[model samples]
Target: MLLAKVIGSVVSTQKSPSLTGKKLLLIQWVNADGSLPAQDQIRTEIAVDSVGAGEGEIVLVTCGSSARRVFPEPNDAIDMAVVGIVDSVSQNLSA
Candidate 1:
Protein backbone atom coordinates (compact mmCIF):
# COMPACT_ATOMS: atom_id res chain seq x y z
CA MET A 1 0.00 0.00 0.00
CA LEU A 2 1.04 3.59 -0.60
CA LEU A 3 0.22 6.67 1.46
CA ALA A 4 -1.17 9.48 -0.66
CA LYS A 5 -3.26 12.62 -0.64
CA VAL A 6 -6.52 12.84 -2.58
CA ILE A 7 -5.92 15.86 -4.77
CA GLY A 8 -8.99 15.58 -6.97
CA SER A 9 -11.52 13.37 -8.70
CA VAL A 10 -11.81 11.68 -12.11
CA VAL A 11 -15.05 11.52 -14.03
CA SER A 12 -15.50 8.81 -16.61
CA THR A 13 -18.67 8.78 -18.65
CA GLN A 14 -17.66 5.58 -20.39
CA LYS A 15 -16.00 2.77 -18.52
CA SER A 16 -15.90 -0.99 -18.18
CA PRO A 17 -19.05 -2.58 -16.88
CA SER A 18 -17.31 -3.71 -13.73
CA LEU A 19 -16.61 -0.11 -12.80
CA THR A 20 -20.08 1.27 -13.46
CA GLY A 21 -20.69 2.89 -10.09
CA LYS A 22 -17.12 3.32 -8.89
CA LYS A 23 -15.58 6.65 -7.97
CA LEU A 24 -12.17 7.55 -9.27
CA LEU A 25 -9.75 9.86 -7.53
CA LEU A 26 -6.58 11.66 -8.45
CA ILE A 27 -3.88 11.11 -5.87
CA GLN A 28 -0.34 12.17 -5.22
CA TRP A 29 1.96 10.19 -2.99
CA VAL A 30 3.03 11.97 0.18
CA ASN A 31 6.61 12.74 1.13
CA ALA A 32 8.36 11.37 4.22
CA ASP A 33 7.15 14.37 6.21
CA GLY A 34 3.52 13.52 5.37
CA SER A 35 3.31 16.53 3.10
CA LEU A 36 2.37 16.73 -0.57
CA PRO A 37 5.10 16.83 -3.15
CA ALA A 38 5.59 20.06 -5.10
CA GLN A 39 3.23 20.64 -8.01
CA ASP A 40 6.05 20.56 -10.53
CA GLN A 41 7.30 17.30 -9.09
CA ILE A 42 3.96 15.62 -8.61
CA ARG A 43 3.41 12.19 -10.11
CA THR A 44 -0.35 11.93 -9.93
CA GLU A 45 -2.30 8.70 -10.31
CA ILE A 46 -5.94 7.60 -10.52
CA ALA A 47 -7.31 5.23 -7.95
CA VAL A 48 -10.73 3.68 -7.52
CA ASP A 49 -12.32 4.92 -4.30
CA SER A 50 -13.10 1.94 -2.09
CA VAL A 51 -13.23 3.78 1.25
CA GLY A 52 -15.23 6.87 0.33
CA ALA A 53 -12.26 9.19 0.82
CA GLY A 54 -12.83 12.79 -0.20
CA GLU A 55 -10.57 15.42 -1.69
CA GLY A 56 -7.84 16.77 0.61
CA GLU A 57 -8.00 13.58 2.65
CA ILE A 58 -5.02 11.34 3.27
CA VAL A 59 -5.71 7.84 2.00
CA LEU A 60 -4.16 4.43 1.57
CA VAL A 61 -3.82 3.16 -1.98
CA THR A 62 -3.35 -0.46 -2.82
CA CYS A 63 -1.83 -1.25 -6.17
CA GLY A 64 -1.48 -4.07 -8.67
CA SER A 65 -3.18 -7.36 -7.96
CA SER A 66 -3.88 -6.47 -4.38
CA ALA A 67 -5.99 -3.55 -5.45
CA ARG A 68 -8.19 -5.70 -7.65
CA ARG A 69 -9.13 -7.79 -4.66
CA VAL A 70 -11.44 -5.11 -3.33
CA PHE A 71 -13.93 -5.70 -6.06
CA PRO A 72 -16.41 -8.55 -6.06
CA GLU A 73 -14.80 -9.98 -9.15
CA PRO A 74 -11.09 -10.65 -9.19
CA ASN A 75 -10.93 -9.62 -12.82
CA ASP A 76 -12.00 -6.04 -12.20
CA ALA A 77 -10.01 -3.56 -14.26
CA ILE A 78 -8.28 -1.82 -11.41
CA ASP A 79 -4.62 -1.37 -10.78
CA MET A 80 -4.99 0.97 -7.83
CA ALA A 81 -7.70 1.55 -5.24
CA VAL A 82 -8.15 3.81 -2.25
CA VAL A 83 -8.52 1.18 0.44
CA GLY A 84 -8.28 3.22 3.62
CA ILE A 85 -8.74 6.71 5.00
CA VAL A 86 -6.04 7.93 7.34
CA ASP A 87 -7.07 9.68 10.54
CA SER A 88 -3.53 10.11 11.78
CA VAL A 89 0.03 8.92 11.30
CA SER A 90 2.35 8.45 14.24
CA GLN A 91 6.05 7.71 14.38
CA ASN A 92 7.54 5.71 17.19
CA LEU A 93 9.89 7.80 19.33
CA SER A 94 12.15 4.79 19.82
CA ALA A 95 12.52 4.31 16.09
Candidate 2:
Protein backbone atom coordinates (compact mmCIF):
# COMPACT_ATOMS: atom_id res chain seq x y z
CA MET A 1 0.00 0.00 0.00
CA LEU A 2 1.04 3.62 -0.62
CA LEU A 3 -0.09 7.17 0.09
CA ALA A 4 -1.22 9.40 -2.74
CA LYS A 5 -3.46 12.29 -3.79
CA VAL A 6 -6.16 12.25 -6.45
CA ILE A 7 -4.91 14.74 -9.00
CA GLY A 8 -7.39 14.14 -11.79
CA SER A 9 -9.61 11.59 -13.54
CA VAL A 10 -9.29 9.48 -16.67
CA VAL A 11 -12.12 9.17 -19.18
CA SER A 12 -11.97 6.10 -21.32
CA THR A 13 -14.99 4.83 -23.16
CA GLN A 14 -13.06 1.92 -24.60
CA LYS A 15 -11.23 -0.35 -22.16
CA SER A 16 -10.91 -3.96 -21.25
CA PRO A 17 -14.12 -5.78 -20.34
CA SER A 18 -12.90 -6.26 -16.81
CA LEU A 19 -12.43 -2.51 -16.44
CA THR A 20 -15.97 -1.68 -17.37
CA GLY A 21 -17.88 0.50 -14.87
CA LYS A 22 -14.71 1.21 -12.90
CA LYS A 23 -13.74 4.80 -12.23
CA LEU A 24 -10.18 5.64 -13.21
CA LEU A 25 -8.57 8.52 -11.40
CA LEU A 26 -5.15 10.02 -11.88
CA ILE A 27 -3.50 9.93 -8.49
CA GLN A 28 -0.01 11.15 -7.73
CA TRP A 29 1.83 9.36 -4.96
CA VAL A 30 2.92 11.59 -2.12
CA ASN A 31 5.97 11.32 0.08
CA ALA A 32 6.04 11.18 3.86
CA ASP A 33 6.05 14.95 3.87
CA GLY A 34 2.67 14.96 2.09
CA SER A 35 4.13 16.23 -1.14
CA LEU A 36 4.34 14.39 -4.44
CA PRO A 37 7.68 13.54 -6.05
CA ALA A 38 8.50 14.90 -9.49
CA GLN A 39 11.21 12.45 -10.52
CA ASP A 40 8.90 9.56 -11.37
CA GLN A 41 5.27 10.38 -10.92
CA ILE A 42 3.10 7.65 -9.42
CA ARG A 43 -0.53 7.25 -10.38
CA THR A 44 -3.18 5.19 -8.62
CA GLU A 45 -6.36 3.53 -9.91
CA ILE A 46 -9.64 4.09 -8.10
CA ALA A 47 -12.65 1.82 -8.52
CA VAL A 48 -16.16 3.13 -8.96
CA ASP A 49 -17.38 5.13 -5.99
CA SER A 50 -19.60 8.03 -4.97
CA VAL A 51 -17.09 9.38 -2.44
CA GLY A 52 -16.88 12.59 -4.48
CA ALA A 53 -13.19 13.22 -3.87
CA GLY A 54 -11.28 15.68 -5.98
CA GLU A 55 -7.76 16.97 -6.60
CA GLY A 56 -5.54 17.39 -3.49
CA GLU A 57 -7.42 14.78 -1.48
CA ILE A 58 -5.00 12.52 0.39
CA VAL A 59 -5.95 8.92 -0.25
CA LEU A 60 -4.72 5.42 0.38
CA VAL A 61 -3.78 3.24 -2.58
CA THR A 62 -3.27 -0.50 -2.64
CA CYS A 63 -1.26 -1.97 -5.47
CA GLY A 64 0.07 -5.26 -6.83
CA SER A 65 -2.12 -8.39 -6.70
CA SER A 66 -4.25 -6.81 -4.00
CA ALA A 67 -5.59 -4.25 -6.43
CA ARG A 68 -7.53 -6.84 -8.38
CA ARG A 69 -9.51 -7.80 -5.29
CA VAL A 70 -11.43 -4.52 -5.41
CA PHE A 71 -13.54 -5.88 -8.20
CA PRO A 72 -15.66 -8.96 -8.62
CA GLU A 73 -13.16 -10.32 -11.12
CA PRO A 74 -10.02 -10.93 -9.13
CA ASN A 75 -7.99 -11.61 -12.25
CA ASP A 76 -8.49 -8.12 -13.63
CA ALA A 77 -5.38 -6.32 -14.80
CA ILE A 78 -5.04 -3.63 -12.16
CA ASP A 79 -1.94 -2.25 -10.55
CA MET A 80 -3.43 0.19 -8.08
CA ALA A 81 -6.66 1.30 -6.32
CA VAL A 82 -7.67 4.06 -3.94
CA VAL A 83 -9.08 2.46 -0.83
CA GLY A 84 -9.65 5.39 1.48
CA ILE A 85 -9.51 9.12 1.94
CA VAL A 86 -7.33 10.55 4.68
CA ASP A 87 -9.01 12.88 7.11
CA SER A 88 -5.89 13.88 9.01
CA VAL A 89 -2.27 12.93 9.61
CA SER A 90 0.04 13.77 12.50
CA GLN A 91 3.62 12.74 13.21
CA ASN A 92 4.49 12.44 16.86
CA LEU A 93 8.19 12.89 16.21
CA SER A 94 9.12 15.38 13.53
CA ALA A 95 11.08 13.91 10.67
Candidate 3:
Protein backbone atom coordinates (compact mmCIF):
# COMPACT_ATOMS: atom_id res chain seq x y z
CA MET A 1 0.00 0.00 0.00
CA LEU A 2 1.01 3.63 -0.58
CA LEU A 3 -0.14 7.08 0.44
CA ALA A 4 -1.21 9.37 -2.35
CA LYS A 5 -2.88 12.74 -2.88
CA VAL A 6 -5.82 13.05 -5.22
CA ILE A 7 -4.74 15.36 -8.04
CA GLY A 8 -7.81 15.21 -10.22
CA SER A 9 -10.00 12.84 -12.24
CA VAL A 10 -10.15 11.21 -15.67
CA VAL A 11 -13.23 11.12 -17.82
CA SER A 12 -13.62 8.92 -20.86
CA THR A 13 -16.58 8.44 -23.11
CA GLN A 14 -15.34 5.21 -24.67
CA LYS A 15 -13.48 2.57 -22.69
CA SER A 16 -13.19 -1.16 -22.10
CA PRO A 17 -16.20 -3.23 -21.09
CA SER A 18 -15.05 -3.90 -17.57
CA LEU A 19 -14.25 -0.23 -16.96
CA THR A 20 -17.71 1.00 -17.67
CA GLY A 21 -19.23 3.13 -14.88
CA LYS A 22 -15.96 3.14 -12.97
CA LYS A 23 -14.40 6.37 -11.73
CA LEU A 24 -10.80 6.87 -12.80
CA LEU A 25 -8.71 9.27 -10.75
CA LEU A 26 -5.31 10.94 -10.94
CA ILE A 27 -3.13 10.78 -7.83
CA GLN A 28 0.39 11.70 -6.81
CA TRP A 29 2.47 9.62 -4.44
CA VAL A 30 2.85 11.04 -0.93
CA ASN A 31 4.88 10.29 2.18
CA ALA A 32 3.55 7.80 4.70
CA ASP A 33 2.49 10.66 6.98
CA GLY A 34 0.71 12.33 4.07
CA SER A 35 2.97 15.36 3.98
CA LEU A 36 3.25 17.13 0.66
CA PRO A 37 6.26 18.80 -1.02
CA ALA A 38 6.91 15.21 -2.03
CA GLN A 39 10.34 13.74 -2.14
CA ASP A 40 11.06 13.43 -5.86
CA GLN A 41 7.59 12.14 -6.69
CA ILE A 42 5.62 14.87 -8.41
CA ARG A 43 4.35 12.81 -11.30
CA THR A 44 0.70 11.80 -11.16
CA GLU A 45 -0.72 8.35 -11.82
CA ILE A 46 -4.14 6.81 -12.33
CA ALA A 47 -6.17 4.51 -10.11
CA VAL A 48 -9.64 3.03 -9.91
CA ASP A 49 -11.65 4.67 -7.12
CA SER A 50 -13.14 2.16 -4.68
CA VAL A 51 -13.93 4.75 -2.01
CA GLY A 52 -15.48 8.11 -2.67
CA ALA A 53 -12.26 10.13 -2.76
CA GLY A 54 -12.20 13.69 -3.99
CA GLU A 55 -9.54 16.10 -5.20
CA GLY A 56 -6.98 17.36 -2.68
CA GLU A 57 -7.65 14.48 -0.33
CA ILE A 58 -5.12 12.03 1.04
CA VAL A 59 -5.88 8.43 0.04
CA LEU A 60 -4.62 4.90 0.42
CA VAL A 61 -3.56 3.24 -2.79
CA THR A 62 -3.18 -0.47 -3.45
CA CYS A 63 -1.56 -1.90 -6.53
CA GLY A 64 -0.93 -5.06 -8.57
CA SER A 65 -2.70 -8.30 -7.54
CA SER A 66 -3.94 -6.66 -4.38
CA ALA A 67 -5.64 -4.02 -6.43
CA ARG A 68 -7.41 -6.65 -8.51
CA ARG A 69 -9.00 -8.01 -5.37
CA VAL A 70 -10.53 -4.65 -4.40
CA PHE A 71 -13.42 -5.45 -6.67
CA PRO A 72 -16.06 -8.15 -6.51
CA GLU A 73 -14.87 -10.15 -9.55
CA PRO A 74 -11.16 -9.90 -8.59
CA ASN A 75 -10.26 -10.59 -12.20
CA ASP A 76 -10.64 -7.16 -13.64
CA ALA A 77 -7.84 -5.27 -15.36
CA ILE A 78 -7.44 -2.81 -12.51
CA ASP A 79 -3.77 -2.32 -11.77
CA MET A 80 -4.20 0.32 -9.05
CA ALA A 81 -7.04 1.28 -6.76
CA VAL A 82 -7.88 3.96 -4.21
CA VAL A 83 -9.08 1.89 -1.29
CA GLY A 84 -9.30 4.30 1.64
CA ILE A 85 -9.57 8.00 2.36
CA VAL A 86 -6.90 8.71 4.91
CA ASP A 87 -7.64 10.93 7.89
CA SER A 88 -4.24 10.74 9.57
CA VAL A 89 -1.08 8.62 9.60
CA SER A 90 0.96 7.97 12.70
CA GLN A 91 3.93 5.73 13.28
CA ASN A 92 6.92 5.24 15.55
CA LEU A 93 10.07 3.52 14.26
CA SER A 94 13.19 2.50 16.04
CA ALA A 95 16.39 1.59 14.31
Candidate 4:
Protein backbone atom coordinates (compact mmCIF):
# COMPACT_ATOMS: atom_id res chain seq x y z
CA MET A 1 0.00 0.00 0.00
CA LEU A 2 1.06 3.60 -0.54
CA LEU A 3 -0.03 7.05 0.52
CA ALA A 4 -1.07 9.49 -2.19
CA LYS A 5 -3.20 12.54 -2.87
CA VAL A 6 -5.99 12.65 -5.44
CA ILE A 7 -4.88 15.51 -7.63
CA GLY A 8 -7.36 15.22 -10.47
CA SER A 9 -9.63 12.93 -12.46
CA VAL A 10 -9.72 11.20 -15.83
CA VAL A 11 -12.67 10.85 -18.17
CA SER A 12 -12.80 8.37 -20.99
CA THR A 13 -15.71 7.87 -23.32
CA GLN A 14 -14.16 4.81 -24.93
CA LYS A 15 -12.80 2.28 -22.46
CA SER A 16 -12.77 -1.38 -21.55
CA PRO A 17 -16.05 -3.11 -20.80
CA SER A 18 -15.00 -3.98 -17.27
CA LEU A 19 -14.28 -0.31 -16.55
CA THR A 20 -17.73 0.89 -17.55
CA GLY A 21 -18.64 2.43 -14.22
CA LYS A 22 -15.32 2.94 -12.56
CA LYS A 23 -13.99 6.39 -11.63
CA LEU A 24 -10.38 7.15 -12.47
CA LEU A 25 -8.35 9.62 -10.47
CA LEU A 26 -4.90 11.13 -10.88
CA ILE A 27 -2.75 10.56 -7.82
CA GLN A 28 0.61 11.89 -6.68
CA TRP A 29 2.69 9.95 -4.18
CA VAL A 30 2.91 11.40 -0.70
CA ASN A 31 5.88 11.15 1.58
CA ALA A 32 5.75 9.21 4.86
CA ASP A 33 5.52 12.49 6.73
CA GLY A 34 2.31 13.28 4.78
CA SER A 35 4.04 15.87 2.64
CA LEU A 36 3.99 15.77 -1.11
CA PRO A 37 7.28 15.00 -2.76
CA ALA A 38 8.95 17.18 -5.37
CA GLN A 39 7.26 17.12 -8.76
CA ASP A 40 10.33 15.75 -10.48
CA GLN A 41 10.78 13.10 -7.81
CA ILE A 42 7.20 11.81 -7.98
CA ARG A 43 5.22 10.14 -10.69
CA THR A 44 1.50 10.69 -11.01
CA GLU A 45 -0.76 7.87 -12.19
CA ILE A 46 -4.41 7.07 -12.63
CA ALA A 47 -6.11 4.83 -10.12
CA VAL A 48 -9.61 3.39 -9.85
CA ASP A 49 -11.56 5.13 -7.12
CA SER A 50 -12.97 2.35 -4.98
CA VAL A 51 -13.55 4.46 -1.86
CA GLY A 52 -14.93 7.56 -3.56
CA ALA A 53 -11.89 9.67 -2.72
CA GLY A 54 -12.16 13.21 -4.09
CA GLU A 55 -9.62 15.70 -5.30
CA GLY A 56 -7.04 16.96 -2.76
CA GLU A 57 -7.83 14.14 -0.34
CA ILE A 58 -5.11 11.88 0.99
CA VAL A 59 -5.90 8.32 0.00
CA LEU A 60 -4.51 4.88 0.48
CA VAL A 61 -3.43 3.33 -2.81
CA THR A 62 -3.07 -0.35 -3.53
CA CYS A 63 -1.25 -1.40 -6.66
CA GLY A 64 -0.40 -4.45 -8.76
CA SER A 65 -2.24 -7.74 -8.27
CA SER A 66 -3.59 -6.60 -4.94
CA ALA A 67 -5.58 -3.89 -6.73
CA ARG A 68 -7.23 -6.47 -8.95
CA ARG A 69 -8.61 -8.22 -5.87
CA VAL A 70 -10.88 -5.29 -5.12
CA PHE A 71 -13.14 -6.11 -8.01
CA PRO A 72 -15.33 -9.18 -8.24
CA GLU A 73 -14.17 -9.96 -11.79
CA PRO A 74 -10.55 -10.31 -10.63
CA ASN A 75 -9.56 -9.76 -14.25
CA ASP A 76 -10.60 -6.12 -14.23
CA ALA A 77 -7.99 -3.87 -15.85
CA ILE A 78 -7.12 -2.26 -12.59
CA ASP A 79 -3.45 -1.84 -11.83
CA MET A 80 -4.03 0.69 -9.06
CA ALA A 81 -6.93 1.56 -6.76
CA VAL A 82 -7.89 4.04 -4.08
CA VAL A 83 -8.71 1.63 -1.30
CA GLY A 84 -9.28 4.08 1.57
CA ILE A 85 -9.50 7.76 2.44
CA VAL A 86 -7.08 9.00 5.07
CA ASP A 87 -8.52 11.08 7.85
CA SER A 88 -5.30 11.49 9.79
CA VAL A 89 -1.82 10.03 10.09
CA SER A 90 0.24 9.44 13.20
CA GLN A 91 3.95 8.73 13.26
CA ASN A 92 6.39 8.18 16.10
CA LEU A 93 9.44 10.35 15.55
CA SER A 94 11.47 8.60 18.27
CA ALA A 95 12.41 5.09 17.40
- Lowest-scoring 10 consecutive residues by lDDT in candidate 1? 68-77
lDDT of 4 by residue, 1-95 (tens): 89999999999989887788888999999997778788788989999988888999999999998998888783468889999999888888896
Candidate 2 lDDT over 1-95, as tens digits, reads 67778878888887777777767778777886688677767544554322456777887787776777766673476767777788877767756
For TM-score, candidate 1 versus 2, the one ahead is: 1
Candidate numbers, best TM-score first, in rank order: 4, 1, 3, 2
Q: Residue 80 error for model 4, in Å?
A: 0.4
Tens digits of per-residue lDDT for model 1, 54-95? 999999999998898887773378999999999888877689
Best by lDDT: 4
Which candidate order results from sorting by lDDT in descending order? 4, 1, 3, 2
User: Considering summed lDDT, which 10 consecutive residues are worst modelled in model 4?
Assistant: 68-77
Model 4 clashing residue pairs (backbone)? none
Q: Root-mean-square deviation of each candidate, in angstroms? A: 2.0, 3.1, 2.2, 1.4
The clash count for each model shown is 0, 0, 0, 0
Off by over 4 Å in 1: 38-41
Query: Could you tell me every candidate's TM-score relative to the true structure?
Result: 0.86, 0.75, 0.83, 0.91
Give the clashing pairs for model 3: none
Candidate 4 residue spans exceeding 4 A from truth? none
Question: Mind giving the per-residue lDDT tens digits that candidate 3 earns over 1-95?
Answer: 88999989999888766677888999998877666655575768899999999999999999998997888773477899999999887787672
RMSD of 3: 2.2
Q: What's the CA error at residue 6 for candidate 4, in Å? A: 0.4
